[model samples]
Target: MERMKEDQDQIYYHSGADLESVKDSPFLEKLIKKGYEVLYLTQAIDENMITQLLDYEGTKFMSISKDNFKFGEKDQKEEKEKNKALKKMYKPLTKFLKKKLGDKVSKVRLSNRLSDTVCVLASDQYGYSARMEIIMRAQAFADPDSFGYMTPKSKIMELNAHHPITKEMLRLVESGEDDERAAELGHLVYDTALVASGYVMRDSDYKSYADRMYKWIGESVGVDPSAPIVEEYPEEEKADSEEEKSDGDANLKEASSSSADPASEDHSEDSSEDHDELLYRSRTRVEDEVFMATVSVF
Candidate 1:
């Protein structure tokens, strides 16, 4: 509060894991670049604590990551007019993103808060902050039933219409020739914004993000994403397999030849008879030993 300018009536704050993280957040790029003072709330309890203290000394506390955040009142009209023009210009792109992102985002719109960043995810005014959601999720892990009622509202994706990637996406969306590519790009941007805004992505969302990333990487390297990966066996491995097969065939032939020989069959029958005779003598000797031992004990 002491750091606020004389005319500043709003105390802007951002919640994050640490000071460096909140300071380097994409959500604060435009605000920071414009010389706006933002309080970096890094403690686990800061978000929850700030909610209770809504206002300090008549200066309202506002999170820059919320959808209802606004800049100074002096240029409010001008900013709205500019945003209106941009919304109209990028209507198709917004529509495409909304359709592609589905329920992940509450809405897709052009952002006035972004300057250097391509996009960012913003929470609802009264909804949970990204940090709060993280805390709630951690709590839910311990007592799932108690926190089952806690469901975070979908985030609002704010895209920088001035960014080159956004412009290219707009073009891809307008052209309709690369609808699939455009959809992939839209999903990629949304997933990136989710992480940038410090929200945990669902399993399916992460899977889609990984698939898109791999596809783009493959495309960049001139590889066909749809092509099947074929594993090639080495010449040495093939030679070894053939040698084993040949050895098995030779062993099988030798066994068959030995089984077919009359002399070998006679020898096998003689060996069986001799084995039975040896077993009979061994049992008789054991019985004799047991009788002698019993007599001595008596």
Candidate 2:
């Protein structure tokens, strides 16, 4: 029964309602970006059948999340030289992150897959994908050393050399006397990469990252880092309460005056009259906005 359950769990698959839904999916994004047609296994039994059959004719099956999956031709000499120079330039930062991240990451390398993204977490060819690892960890029967015989241990962090943030990181390491800030940046980058790769860290680590981010943001915007963490906390709450109380009369006046504005009234009437249409428009607008944001970032 346990073996049957495990096999059933392994026989997983996914299907998109339409091509556009998974058009720029992370699993297929790089391939699509480089112009490749992927055969997506949509049926639940497809993965099981493929595993049993091993291959179709001369073609072998591959996982997109694995490091060995290649899309196009190898990098030429010129491209290789360019990448070598970038690796050389970012060596300091990479070494620093490797030491700081320690056992969390297996290795760090310059990313060839990313075009505009700053960083990505990739598993070694023989290791499980980050998503699969997370699922395993969440299982009731999970063991910390479940795959004890695996040669590869942790995920690899791939940093894009072309991104401005990556360049800034390189600069920070090169600049002397900024070791504190640089270390903080390294932790931030690693945490960001971990989350992006669909893994979660310890709660304490998350809290520490948040505190460091607050300090860095404060320093960036000219806030005094030496200031007390909670200077007059209750007093601050009292002042906020006072302000909220004071706004009540002004809000009432604004509400009274808003009745005289025909445009506001028309808008409110239209919103109330066609609630379903308004909700649909709002949902679509939000979806489009989110898609545009993803495009801009990824």
Please give the distance, in angstroms, between residue 169's alpha carbon in candidate 2 and its true position after superposition: 0.8
The residue-by-residue lDDT of candidate 1 on 1-298, one tens digit each, is: 7766555568999999998898889999877766778988999999889999999878889999888898877545666888887899999999988887778878999998899999999988877788887888786347645554444546799999899999999999888999998998988888888888898888666776887899999999999888998999999999999999999999999999998899989998999999999999999999999999999999
Over 4 Å off, model 2: 1-30, 39-54, 74-81, 147-153, 224-226, 230-298
- TM per prediction: 0.76, 0.60
lDDT of all predictions: 0.86, 0.66
- Per-residue lDDT tens digits for candidate 2, residues 1-298, read 1322221212212223235533433455444455444555543345446546755554466555567654433332344667887888889989987887788688888876677567877767666555455545666877767754432456688888888888888888888568777778877887887776555566667788888778878889999776977855688899989899889978988888987789988998888879988888999999999999999998
TM-score, structure 2 vs. true: 0.60
User: In candidate 2, where is summed lDDT lowest over 10 consecutive residues?
Assistant: 5-14
Clashing residue pair totals per candidate (backbone < 3 A): 0, 0
